[model samples]
Target: MRVKVDADKCEGHNRCCALAPELFDVDDYGTATALNDGNVPPELEEKAKLAVQNCPEYAIEFVKD
Candidate 1:
């Protein structure tokens, strides 16, 4: 699985970063971006999913690889 962040939809809540820092990063303005181009390592899959679930803006999403 892979992760994707919709910058336009993101309200910079940082929930994705808070829940899965390994999968996301937040800018100084609090905009979130997926780490490593949103590639999810096998071990980090659950964390990635958790990040998506926790994003109040629903900006984080999972993509099939």
Candidate 2:
């Protein structure tokens, strides 16, 4: 699975980083960027999902490959 954040939809909440620090990076301005290329490691799958669910802007999405 691959995850991506929609810059247009994101409001820089940083919630994704809060939920999954290893999976996301939040800048000083609070723009959240996906880490590990948004590659969902098996151990981090659940946490990634939580991040997706908690995003207020619904900006995170997964691409199944």
Candidate 3:
């Protein structure tokens, strides 16, 4: 599974990082950055999807490969 973040659509929400810190990181300014270039480990795939689902700004997306 792969996760994608639309920085342009992000609203500085840290939910993604909060949900899965290993998979996502929040900058000092509160923007989110993907730690794995969209590649998520199988164990963390669910959390990644949860992060995408919980993003208030609808900035995160998950793609299955």
Candidate 4:
């Protein structure tokens, strides 16, 4: 599965990065950005979902492609 992060909804919380550093990147201001083009590896799928679930803004989502 793939994932995508909503830049508009991100509020620099960094929770996503804290949960899954490999899947996310934190900006200078602490906003989270998905890594690897948000293309989650199978082994890391659960971590990706956890990051999405823990985001306070609910800015992360699975992409259907």
Candidate 5:
């Protein structure tokens, strides 16, 4: 599975980064960004999904391949 973060929708909450720092990172403004070029590691997919679910602004999404 792949993950996508809509920077436009993000409110710099940092929840995604907090949930999976290995998979996500926060930009200078604190918006969540993918650390792996949008590729979600199989082991971290659940955490990534949780990040997506926990995003208050609905900024994260999973794109299944």
Candidate 6:
């Protein structure tokens, strides 16, 4: 599975970054972006799901690979 962050929907909450630093990165302005072009490693899939659930803005989404 892969993940994508919607820049327009994101509110800079950074929950994804805090929960899954391996998969996300927060910018100086606090906007969170997916790492590795939103590609999720096998081991980090669960963490990605967790981040998705925790995002209040619902800006994170799973992408079919």
lDDT of each: 0.91, 0.89, 0.89, 0.90, 0.87, 0.93
Instruction: Give the per-residue lDDT digits (tens) of candidate 4, residues 9-44.
Output: 999889889889999998897777889899998999
Question: Lowest-scoring 10 consecutive residues by lDDT in candidate 2?
Answer: 27-36
* Segments in model 2 whose C-alpha atoms lie over 4 Å from true places: none
Provide the RMSD of all predictions against the true structure, rounded to 1 decimal. 0.7, 0.9, 1.1, 0.7, 1.0, 0.7
lDDT of 3 at 51: 97
Task: Name the TM-score of candidate 1.
Answer: 0.94
TM-score of each: 0.94, 0.92, 0.91, 0.94, 0.91, 0.94
- TM-score of candidate 5 to 2 decimals: 0.91
Stretches of candidate 5 exceeding 4 Å from the true structure? none
> Candidate 6's residue-wise lDDT over 1-65, tens digit each?
88999988899998999999999998888888899999998999899999999999999999997
Q: Which is the winner by lDDT between candidate 1 and candidate 2?
A: 1
Give the per-residue lDDT of model 5 (tens digit) for 1-65.
88889989999999988898888888798877887688976898789889989999999998866
Give the worst 10-residue stretch by lDDT in candidate 1: 56-65
Write the number of the candidate with greater TM-score, choosing between 1 and 2: 1
> Among all windows of ten consecutive residues in candidate 4, which has the lowest summed lDDT?
26-35
Stretches off by above 4 angstroms in model 4 are none
Tens-digit lDDT track of model 1 for 1-65: 89999999999988888888898999999999999999999999999989989888888888877
Query: Any runs in candidate 6 off by more than 4 Å, and if so which?
Result: none
